[model samples]
Target: MTGASGNVGRQVVEQLVAAGEPVRALSRDPARTEWPDGVETVAGDLVGGVPTEAFNGVRALHLFPAPEGVDAVVAAAVAAGVVHVTVLSSLSASWETDSPLQRRHTVVERAVEGSGLGWTHLRPGMFMTNTLAWAPAVRAGEPVRAPFGDSVAAPVHEADIAAVAVAALLDPARHAGAVHELSGPEALSQRDRVRVLGEVLGREVRFEEQSRAEARADLLRNPWMNEQLADSLLAMQERTVGVRDGLVLPAVDEVLDRPGRSFAEWVADHREAFTGPV
Candidate 1:
């Protein structure tokens, strides 16, 4: 697994562990992590490069897409004799507007599709975990802010996405060439999710919609954001506000042999973020 330390990657690691699958985790900083006792953790930088030897004994890998230079990763995985690689992609992939993040995924997907390595693409919708972006304000008892609280997205659970990844990794024949469009069991607006959070936490949470100008101003104040990315975030909000809903795949149930989790359940399980605890 490439991003064993990230949100989705962490969950995928946990699922792989429980299934007793021997894994070779790909990580940028091995010292920072305390991986499970039995798993072999490799210390190397993915952004810098993915070491070909990491895939030496590995038959499959969980990979992430960053634009920098992943041709090396494709070569390394192929050289290591990897049979399959699963990619975590997003709905922004349609590329009607050329989002930078989408561009990164596009680059990696194009490379892997022709890289001679068998592949499966898991394109999940808006993440329910993105609600964590509101954690600080939610814990502060303030309103969650966005440019379009009215935007509707059939967001899927991160764990569910991970589940699909683990499923495909373990059973590559079933998922090869499959592009799963994952989403929550139900379609909902941003406002609807906040309302769900409120219902689950027994507190009234509110959303404040910032105008495009105000949104840009607030985003620019952050040192980490550039204009293009900030504007793209706002643009996604604008695009999703009335686009009906995205495709919800049954691949989850078919692959995992159980129904996928729901947003309300995800909220209920992780209610601590909204209930005053960090």
Candidate 2:
């Protein structure tokens, strides 16, 4: 599985291991992190060609969306006898808008679609983990600040996203050619999420709204984010403010046969992030 060290990918690795599946995990530097017993760790960079040996004897692949060299990776998977592929994609890719985020994921999705292998696209909306960035502020007894504090999003847990991917990988026949749009069980405004966190932490977690410029500058602080991508994300947040209709999807429940986890549950599971030392 590519990106085996990432947020969703790590969960996917854990779930696959729990199921007794022989997993060959690929990452830029496999030695950086330890894998479970019996997991075959392969050092391969998706952007720089994935080593052919990584796909050897592999039946299905969990793919990460690294646009560079993606087509070649799919071709290599096809040549190495991979039967199915599950792509970690974004919900923006399924939207009608042509934002950079959508276009970026779309490129990878298109490559997988034409690969002649069974494919499942896990298009998850805003990740609940995005709020992890607010941990420092919460831990410092300050308000969690972000733009579009009223924006409504059903932020999905990374676990649910990975569960769906694991299901697709294990049951290719049942999930092949499927596009799963996933989200949390309910839509909540950004402020509401903060309130939920407060309830979980037994403190008054406050929300401080930011201007668009401030949010854009904050996003640009990430080395992985460019101006175009940051602006695209900000635009998405701006558009979703107070949006209550169709922001949530049932694919998570249908695919996993369990309701998507609520934001409060996510907060409870990650309470330490906000309560830990600075």
Candidate 3:
């Protein structure tokens, strides 16, 4: 699977391995990637042409959006005789906005759809793992600062996304041509999310709202971020405030035959990250 070391991909690899399925994990630096026994690690980058051998004997692939080399990756997959592909896309692809984030995933989705391969698209909303950004502040017992404390989001567990991906990859005929919109079981405001974290950690975590100007200035200070992307993110957060940003969909239940997990469950599962030694 490409992007096997990513948040969702890592869970996918783990779940696939737990099911006794042979997995070939692709990494830009294979030497640094640690995998369980019986899993193969290959050195490759999606943007730099995935090695053809990585596709050998592989019936299906879990693909992450890499627009730069997506066409080549699909071509190579077809040439290597891969019959099915499950792509990890985002809800942004379906958004009306024409931002770079949306365009990037949409391009990859279109390429895969037209690649003459049986494909399933996993379009997940905001990930629960995004809350990890508050780790440093939480560790220091500081109130989480953000521009929108009441912005509602259905932050899906990465495991749920991976679960759906694995289901599609294992049974192409069952999930072929499916576009799954995955989300958490419930919607929670940003403040509610912080409360959940506090509940799980057995601490009193607080939420502090930052003005738009303050948030913009703080974001622009980071070299890895730019004004456009920062503005886009803040705009999204603004739009979500007092709105139902999380749309609980039936796709996860339909595919997994169970309801999607709640954000509280996710926090419980990841409590160590919040409460463990810093």
Candidate 4:
């Protein structure tokens, strides 16, 4: 699977291995990637064009929305006789307003859909792992500071996302030509999520609301973030607060035949990241 080392992709790889499937995991740097026994690791990048061997004898593929070389990647998959593909897209793609984030995934989606191959789109909402950004504050026993403390989102577990992807990959007839909008079982505000984290870690974590200016300044200071993206994200959060933007969907339960995991479950599973060394 392409993007096998990524957050959701790593779970996909592991679960696929646990199911006794032969997985060909693609990575930009194969030397640094650790794979389960009997799994093949390939050195490849979506932007650089995936190595042809990675597609050889592969029937189904899991793809990430890397727009730059998406056409080439799909072409290679088709040439190698790949029949089905499950793409990791975002909920932004379904938004009414246009955005760079949405456009990037839309471009890749169009290419894959136009490729004449069976395709399933996995469009997930905010990920539970996004809360990891507060790890440092929690570890230091500091209040988590951010704007829109009451903004709610049904943050999905990375494992659940991967499970849905793997299901689609393994059963094309049931999932092909489908779009799955996955989210967590329940919606929680930012502060509510922090409380859940504290509950799971057996500690008290406080929340501090940051003014728009403070949040903007903090976001701008991050070298990895920029003004446009920051402004867009903040705008979204503003819209979500005291709204129904966090509506939990039934796609996960319908597709996987089980309830989607909750934020508390995710925190319990990842408690170490907040509590430090065991």
Candidate that scores best on lDDT: 2
Per-residue CA lDDT of model 2 for 51-153, tens digit only, reads: 8888889999999999988989999999999999999999999889788899889999999999899999999999999989999999999999999999889
- Evaluated against the true structure, the overall lDDT of model 4 is 0.90
User: 129-223 in candidate 3: lDDT tens per residue?
Assistant: 99988888898888999888888888889999999999998889999999998888888888999998898788899999999999999888989
Candidates in order, TM-scores: namely 0.92, 0.98, 0.95, 0.95
lDDT of 2: 0.92
Candidates 2 and 3, the one with greater lDDT:
2
Residues 1-278 of candidate 1 have per-residue lDDT tens digits of 88898889988888999999887777778778888767788887767876667878888978787656678887888888889989888767755767776886878777889988889988887888888888888888889887787887877889999999988998899889888777777778878888888888888898888788998998889896788888888887787786664446666777777877888899887887777664
Q: Residues 99-218, candidate 4, lDDT per residue (tens digit)?
A: 767887899999999999999999998999999889999888899998999898888999999999999998999998999998899888898998888888887999999998899998
Candidate 3 residue spans exceeding 4 A from truth: 217-224
Q: Cα lDDT for residue 207, model 3?
A: 93
Cα miss at 57, model 4 (Å)?
A: 1.0
What's the lDDT for all of these models?
0.81, 0.92, 0.89, 0.90
User: What local lDDT does model 2 show for residue 181?
Assistant: 94
**What TM-score would you give candidate 4 relative to the actual structure?**
0.95
State which candidate, 1 or 4, has the greater lDDT.
Answer: 4
Error of 1 at 82 (Å): 0.7
lDDT of 3: 0.89
Which 10-residue window in model 3 sums to the lowest lDDT?
A: 243-252
Residue 105, model 3, lDDT:
90
Candidate whose TM-score is highest:
2
The lDDT of model 1 is 0.81
Stretches of model 2 off by over 4 angstroms after superposition: none
